[model samples]
Target: MILEPFPPALPYDFVFKLARDSHDLEGYHKLRREIFCEEQHVFETDDRDLFDESAMPIVCKSLIAGMEDTVVGVVRIDERSSGLWYGSRLGVSSGFRRLRHISPGVAVRNLQPCYAALGALGAGLIYKAVSTACALGCHEFLATVQQQNARFFQRLHWQPLENIMLHGLPHVLMRADLNHYAAAKKVA
Candidate 1:
């Protein structure tokens, strides 16, 4: 009889933090390219833009045995003006997006249950970005969310400002209610 090795357990918990080093930054960029370029075809090669120069990259890292494992989610936040901030390039690894089960009561109208799991992860990344911006003196935070995910953002305390076209796709301009997110502790 032949014996097969067991698969490694998937990570259940994740760490949300600012990409602070080369490893984290590399992971951040790699995942963004995978999602935005390869998966969504939003960009032919790279998805980086001028905003990357001043944008702060935030990562959601999966934890394996209490240690950081991989960058499973990513978002970048930047101050566009004196008190206006924006979050962009939000994504989660396709594999990891299915790692969690949707809670009994959580549901998004007209969307699949799987999205609830995605929203859970997205919420963490959004919170980190919003709080970090708040800590940096941001009075307003905004994002251009995909049309399909507009309702999810609305659930997260973001208000739809207007509809816009971006990256050859339909998107909604949304703003986060600063009152919902408290400023995060200062990051080094």
Candidate 2:
């Protein structure tokens, strides 16, 4: 009997970090517009708002073996008040979705990145945000997620507080359980 060779592994070294320079910042904005405006059709042309002026943006990138770094995902967090934080505008690249049969749970993509690396992209971003919030003395970390993504957050130990409408979309207000994700620990 003939045996098919196992597929070669995809190469990647993923990095999760805060936007440290103009390049990272510009990449983040471009990704947001690409996902939110052009792909999702949630917004007409752009999705920037006053919050972006103060929100801290985080990015997930894939370190290609011999290519430029690709930003595959992004999310923003802001402190609403003392010890209260909010996360929003979670976006993952379409390329990421095409790379792997990722759980509806995680999402992003580009530059021939590994499919496995994209699997944890969303959780990694959230973990970083939670860790940052904790470091900043955040008492509660909250986000309004789309209905389809509510269970994914639940799996990450976030509790759905209520259902609400935002920007004409169905969303659930969720709060991260510090007990479950305390330190922005890396996701395996």
lDDT by residue for model 1 over 1-188, one digit each (tens)?
A: 99999976666666778898999999999999999999999999999999999999999887666677899899999999999999999998888665565333322211212234545668778888898899899998999999988998898889999999998999999999988887876552
* Candidate with best lDDT: 1
Clashes of each: 0, 3
Q: Which ranges in model 1 have alpha carbons more than 4 Å from their true place? A: 1-8, 101-118
Q: Go through the candidates in order and give each one's C-alpha lDDT.
A: 0.82, 0.75
Task: Tell me the RMSD of model 2 versus the true structure.
Answer: 6.7
Residue pairs of candidate 1 with colliding backbone atoms: none
Residue 146, candidate 1: Cα error in Å is: 0.9
True lDDT of residue 28, candidate 2:
94
